[model samples]
Target chain A: MSHSLQHNRRLFLGALGAGLFTTRGAFAEQLLASPALTEGPFYPDQLPLDRDNDLIIINDSLTPAVGEITHLTGKILDASGKPLKDALVEIWQCDANAVYLHTADSGPKKDQQDKNFQGYGAFTTGSTGEYRFRTIKPVPYPGRPSPHIHVKVSQKGRELVTTQLFIRDHAGNLQDGVFLGLRDILDRELVVSDFEPMKNSKMGELACEWDVVIGRTPDEREFERS
Target chain B: MRRVLALSAAVAVCLPLLNSALRAQPPGAPPQGGRGAAAPNAESFLQRLMQYDANGDGSLTLDEVKDRRLHALLNRADANEDGVVTKAELTALHQKESAAIGRQPAGFPPPGAQQPPGAGRGGPPGAQPGPGAGPGPQRRGGRAGQILPEFVQDELELSPEQREQVAELQKEVDAQLEKILTPEQRALLNQPRPGGPGGRQRPPGAGPGRPNGEIREN
Candidate 1:
């Protein structure tokens, strides 16, 4: 009887220790909040007719955009590492010809713009805090040497953060003024993501994942609002 | 008996809590906040090679390499045409190519030196640029200098004032570049071009001279 009792006590202690360890791990593993970047001159002044997650096709049209297709996926998390559901995520980027959807960018280069490219997309994270988008790989434009996608996150009718995602090791990143402006290596690392070739994907599609962590502090919330 | 029952209940409760807490952080959870950590080195040549070892068998077969361009490159390294490339074979090919590069005089390729197929198609992710193909002097440590090349600036159609501003930025970039280079390398960069500015141009239709289709405007 005593032996059985000792075994039960040991099991209880082991379970308790594991529970404590996991709780400590979760609290210790604080995610870096994504740094805010300029919205730039191109946020699609006029939203596209089809603002769906897929930027490759428009309104049942068959022809896809003229560039490498990319599947971008990620999660939205709060400061405490908990997934934030119902957060609206938006992305906008230049087309293959380096023309943005905004008039200031596409107006002059009308001939160069890719008509099929939607160029802007939005998604609302579900219970899992996960979102996905189908878009073309970004290309470098005139002033900006680095190729990038501009991202924004909003919740409860308030903007949380606006940032840019860059191709992790693109050569142009080192030269681009905006990318270099992020002097903190940690900030830069948080914004950069790898665009890897999708396994068994025909049509040369690429895939990338980048999680965004937003600050929950009242001070940061007020600052973001301003 | 009551103590044993209580201990059993505690284990049951704690077990589920531990499992749930572990599940909270899934595998490949995003990076954590801390001192800036270096981005994972996924682009190194070795890592690129290992990607073809689909079965983690430490060897690559032509059929295993799905990318046509990469398949061709590896096929060349398979000197025996046995349809498989081992680490030894790859190392041998690399040494041979390095030797060939060493023999060529700095800043010049021998006439009719065979160019690798698809060398212009941004060849793979980590393909090194051919000699004299990179814009300006070769930069070490993969840090790009010269924010905007003259061709890119011209393409922008910047106004005169904008051009002036860019020129100022270029000067600042140059100053910063000088700080990073060793005195010897700086001196090498200062050396006069062999055939002046005209010597730098790649033979017509040879290649874009820049990768990633950046200069494919026309």
Candidate 2:
């Protein structure tokens, strides 16, 4: 009887340990691979009032952001280099005033926040698995770990991956553990951004091209999950 | 025994015809603005169309055709936006999408932007081409780049402003990238190097994927 009881206890402990580890692993598996970043506290709690193609502007309000506007474009290819058609990419960021769309964003007051920044935008990949977004260049925000762009990729109502794109030249990268962990070239392959001269204006245009590689193998599942 | 043999012969004779008659192919190419991949036998476009088929009907409706989810994709293959997608169109769209899906996040364009005069292409999804002349497969040699040379300079051509616009966008990202990433990461970038457990080398001949399709590095 003692032996049988011991066996049952061992089984119970194993099951309990498995559950605990699973929970921890799910929430904290480390974000690497895909250059896309997290939405952070900037994702709008509610949709913007004036939802245009331009994320740089919140509504049709007269003034746009004082900072440079960027045209972020790129294609999503699989490891095999094939394009994943019909994919959806969502991105969010802080406005020029260092304010995000989230409730926690710091500013003197909520309404006082710069309403010109669109804060978030979505683009659907066409047959070429290519997508584009219009927004302002991400500026430094107070107390944030680094200047980063949070992104999410999805297809057929299923979330494929959500990660952050660290600014390659940011001084904070060395300090950020996540960025350091992705030191390898493949880990940082998509971490790219380029600046272009403005058209008929003083401020130049900012360009960003990120090639995201979604995990197709079974091993890729762990990284893709939130 | 004789009757059973006769029935077996009848079943055998009908099977091949049924298989050929109801193939699960993509609707052929759309009428306008179609990329070369969607021109004929690609598989990706059919997958998107299948998603819109809510009631399992063999055809598409205005609602299915106009689904905003499919706007960018369907537009690539639809050409004229007449709302009906065919198998030939589906093939090209699929091939195009598959390549795009694999492309690096740099701006890539659609294929078939240009064609050698009368060089032959795929059909609209389900619509058969001229007698004995179906849309040929993999005519681009392989997925060269996202933007076809023809389209990049033609009807779907990128205006000088657009090109400048894209270049400026790249510049902005480059600034941010320089400011954000470590010198080590940046060094490895734009050049191939040793990798980690994740595997570094992007295998060659990715079997018709993106990173090509006219995403020129200039």
The model with the greatest lDDT is: 1
Task: List per-candidate RMSD values in Å.
Answer: 16.5, 22.6
| Tens digit per residue, CA lDDT, model 2, A93-147 | 7655555677655233355355666777888888899988777666533323235
Task: Provide fnat values for all models in the order shown.
Answer: 0.01, 0.00
TM-score of each predicted structure versus truth:
0.49, 0.40
Best by TM-score: 1
Docking quality of model 2: it rates as incorrect
Report lDDT (CA) for all predictions. Answer: 0.58, 0.44
Candidate 1 lDDT at B30 equals 24
In model 1, how large is the Cα lDDT of residue A217?
Answer: 25
DockQ for candidate 1: 0.03
Compose the digit string of candidate 2's lDDT tens values, residues B90-175. Answer: 44555444333223222111232211121111111211112212112212212222122212222222333344454455556667
Q: Once superposed on the true structure, which residue ranges of model 2 sit more than 4 Å away at CA? A: A1-39, A106-112, A181-185, A196-203, A218-226, B1-218
Residue-level lDDT of model 1, residues B1-218, one tens digit each, is 99999999766665553442233122112222211322222122333355456666767786655433245357668988888887666655544433332222221222222122221123232222223223333221122364654334332334334556766776788888889999999887766434332233334443212211111111
Cα lDDT tens digits, model 1, A1-226, are: 6964664455344434433432212323344457666667689999999999999998899988877788999889875567889999999998777678999767866776778889999999998899999997776554455678999988866677787899876655654545644433335566788788888998679998888877432211111122
Error of 2 at A125 (Å): 1.5
